[model samples]
Target: MSKSLKAICAVAATTLLLGISAANAGKYNLGRKALPEEIKAWNTDVRPDGQGLPKGQGKVSDGETIYNEQCAACHGDFGEGKDRWPVLVGGKDTLKSDDPVKTIGSYWPYTSTIFDYVRRSMPFGNAQSLSANETYALTAYLLYMNEIIDDEKFVLSDKNFTSVRLPNEKNFTKDVRPDTPTQAQQKPCMKNCKTEVKITGRARVLDVTPDAKKE
Candidate 1:
């Protein structure tokens, strides 16, 4: 056979084998394996150690401008937050109060999370629209507003992302508590759950039932 014919036959065989395998595997032939690009698109998570930060840079000043244009309406001018919206600034020492003001500065543990979250989802209706630099700037701006960063000229980038930390970072420690396993893992008594169910109490005697006479 010709080289092209062999290639075509190989492809056809591979496809047929895959179809047969999938068909015999299970009752539900669902979604295919995720593509590398698809996984990469959703796998834009930046860790606390700044592992997955993209290559970009933004100054706090730039962040402020972007915030005002996109984030201010809901987040307020100074990140005070508008009506029913969450406050992103202040609440530095209100954590112990009866109503703790858990803003980004006071509550979030990692700075990288701020960048990651904003990049993944922000601008309310427009998520994942911010470029890497825009995300960096926004993060830098938030840091400044929260008093985490000292300068508006401070430029934020993936390289220096981990240097900045949230106030709550020191408060967060590794959870040493044991994990609770699901009840589904336990062996259930499917047969003869109980010897018998007896109604030992009378509802009428307990005055739980309505009176027979009309009120």
Candidate 2:
């Protein structure tokens, strides 16, 4: 038999043994898996500079409504934080203070980080439950709460989002901690390294304690 005929017969035998019908067998060409470029098309994420933001509109009032229905229970009505959950407003100059408030405006570096974080994870029980417009509105509401912007509307489109600067934009710096191998290898010692600990000042000094000390 010819080499071509032998190869065709071998394939046919294999297909028959595997119970694959002629109509189904030999109907496809083997190809490589999807490329990174193909996968990235669906994985859109906005960056601090509004790199991947989509076009959408949202108002602070609209966000208030959404927050009431979906987020208020956990995040509080005004983003003041519920129970032990984190607050989403204010903070500002507290970054340099001892007891920093660490709110959205005071601690967050990028406005886009808010949208990106919420898009990726938020609403606690049902993450990614909010639409782009809803996310924008919620972001605007948080901004209002932080006094970054007055109670105005904010629609987080690529064009508008990049314009929103965070109040604590300078609070955090890029990781400048030495990346040198020696530094990375060194473990910080916790005990008795300093010759003396001085009480230069108190952070929160009270006139008197709630309970008086024994005489």
Candidate 3:
């Protein structure tokens, strides 16, 4: 019956009510679980191990045909690229250059990535329109253009997908962040961070920012 006891009881009731509301937050029958078919439709991503590759086959010759028809407008006839579009083929040994040409041949780490990318999004405006066979053929053509595959008659499919590997595949190393030493582990330099500070460059002289007032 005391004022403090009444206040304490009211506070306890409010806390209990809030706990109950929080427990039943998402219990409303708003949305149903996605069907298997619905999930399959969106889960079209292919993996490095050729897990999601559909049952289909294609040759380099067939890929050239598909590439010319579907891909040549944006990417050139031989994947040289049109205007400022991405160049798909050639760029061997250019990774260390001042302006490196990162084509499928020189830079791509895996062959599966090429197939997956082309299958999912390619031909510029028209995306995801290629069949499994078309994707395989295009992938083959790109490999041939890159000189990875000697025989144009070579057929690429889910069976032999892993056999074809990119040249730069060996260059790529696994992320060693977990085992590698980090800067945080080193002793921090709180005082005298540097012996002397020098002006390396001037921002005004660099002219990195555009003269917006001129417009």
Candidate 4:
């Protein structure tokens, strides 16, 4: 074959191969675009600013009733927690203690988080079962139990959801990794960098771990 003709044939072959590969890539139509209702159902997450909260109102008194019926089995009647379950109230100054008890009143940074979590995953096995109004009621009841709000008749709705703020909200700052020195820039020592090695303490001597050899 002529040199120019051979070069043209090679180029044509390469183009054909690339076209075949592109056609075969991800050829299987495994999934389709989600339906509007499906998208709405899965996109039920409420944001910290109450952006996705559903339109509904619930009173603290109503929440207490719903909580006692649906939630008291796991969480106590007043959000004190049952057995090894989570305690949702109190724990005011325990954050600095050795055994810090983090609770909804002391640890959570937003009221929306409380509403969102409970609305999505509460009542133990049955999740996403509470109506919008019921979730708001439960949120209000929790706030009242934590002494954040005093009124039993206080209605919680999307209109004023952002009005209630958690005490720890001020403690949480935005992630500033872009503005701060990275681990590589922090001069992390990877090799024998320490001048001297001293045994501060032994776990066996401190009885921190059980002596399995003694058995």
After superposition on all C-alphas, the RMSD of every candidate to the true structure, in Å, is 10.4, 8.6, 10.3, 9.2
Best by lDDT: 1
**Per-residue C-alpha lDDT of model 2 across residues 1-215, encoded as one tens digit per residue:** 99999999999899776764433445463444567998766576778877788778788888778878887787788787889998886566776789888878778888887888887788886887788888888888777777777746544455677777976676565787566666456787788889988898753454365565544
Query: Residue 89 of model 4: what lDDT?
Result: 86
- Sequence-dependent TM-score of model 3: 0.70
Q: Single out the weakest 10-residue window by summed lDDT for candidate 1.
A: 206-215
Please write out the lDDT profile of model 1 over residues 61-142, one tens digit for every residue: 9999999999999999999999989899998889899979998889999898888899888989999999999999999999
Task: Give Cα-based local distance difference scores for all models.
Answer: 0.88, 0.76, 0.86, 0.87
Instruction: Give the poorly placed runs of model 2, Cα more than 4 Å off.
Output: 1-32, 35-42, 151-154, 176-215
Please write out the lDDT profile of model 3 over residues 164-188, one tens digit for every residue.
Answer: 9898877777786666555676886
Steric clash count of candidate 3: 0
lDDT of 1: 0.88
Every model's TM-score: 0.67, 0.64, 0.70, 0.70
Better of 2 and 4 by lDDT: 4
Q: How many residue-pair clashes does candidate 2 contain?
A: 1
* lDDT for residue 147 in candidate 1, whole number 0-100: 91
